[model samples]
Target: MFDKFLSIDEEKRQRVINAALKVFAQKGYQAASTNEIAREAGISKGLLFHYFTSKKDLYLYLYDYAVKLITETIEQFVDPEERDYFERLKQIAQVKLSVLNDHPDLLGFQKTIFFEDSAEVSAELKARSKEIAETAYYRLFADIDKSKFRPDIDADRAINVILWALEGMGEAERARHRALGIDLDIPYMMEEFDRYLELFKTSFYK
Candidate 1:
């Protein structure tokens, strides 16, 4: 499914990333193998090694790509600029759910890092992931002036709320998928999200 991602240049790097994303997204970090990734990429195993020295290397490469994709999704599209900041927060929640829908296995891969008792994940990957997340959070936080929000609202606490919302939304969806043995019905999810966001708007916004 991810062939043609092994193109031979910088452009191809993005292709490799997409290919890696597909593989890692499907098999996850611990179970994913370099040979399998290479086969999926339509490249020889030796060529895959030439591009990424080890399974860990390919994983970190894809992890960086994922961070950029998630961060950029928030920074650019989550809250359209013409909207109120708190309303934009609702948009952020919706956009987060959309991203999770497109990449359902992402939560599983992410959970592996926090819950795994093994050493499949590298320390560097975790640190870099944290760095990207913090930068994105600060960027989103800067979008709104604290004074403009509810008098009782705390900016740092709000940031924590955002983190909780994003992660929890994904976790909840993953749990539902496991329990039901089917993909999440995202249209219904968005409908419920809009209902709650409206409630938040009514109570929390001036």
Candidate 2:
């Protein structure tokens, strides 16, 4: 659908993409307005539809775009050689936070697409989400230095616990930010992650 858009000016294409991301992220697929997206992107609603056949088409495009961007960012920044699981997770978190800082709507946009129930493309979206998750899980543990883990702890379980704890902490931070009506502060969030990483390392590393 975006073939024509891609063939056009790169800057304008990105403007529309970002505008759609922000709107869909804020209001979800069912509620997002093409008019608002076009206005935000400084394009006509007719032009926006010209680029994408419809709102669903634009949304699916954004989903693909967001996943590709995140996958590329993780691949570029997360070191494959770091053997310590907590350290690797810290690196992943840092890269993720940086991306979220630059594209504040991306995470929200992804979460919206993954959980949306009423969309016609829900099945395809779920499949794409699963594919991304599987790929992420594989990359996260692949080639990690397992020797650093304490011998008594089951490596798989340890990794699962670490993942759960980190996710919980992140959710807590987001909740706090929401309650306080403050934007996510990357520095503060990273500091919290650093503290968690050190604690996990102290407990889990041999």
| Winning model by lDDT | 2
Q: Following a full C-alpha superposition, what root-mean-square deviation does model 2 have from the true structure?
A: 4.1
lDDT of 2 by residue, 112-172 (tens): 7634666587887878766865676567668888788889988777777777787688678
* Poorest lDDT segment (10 consecutive residues) of candidate 2: 110-119
lDDT of residue 140 for candidate 1: 73
Local accuracy of candidate 1 as per-residue lDDT tens digits, 142-202: 6465565578877567556755675676567667766786745657767766765666566
Candidate 2 Cα deviation (angstroms), residue 4: 6.4
RMSD, one per candidate, in order: 5.4, 4.1
- Each candidate structure's TM-score, on Cα atoms with residue i matched to residue i, is 0.66, 0.71
How far out, in Å, is residue 166 in model 1?
4.3
* TM-score, cand. 2 vs. native: 0.71
lDDT, candidate 1, equals 0.64
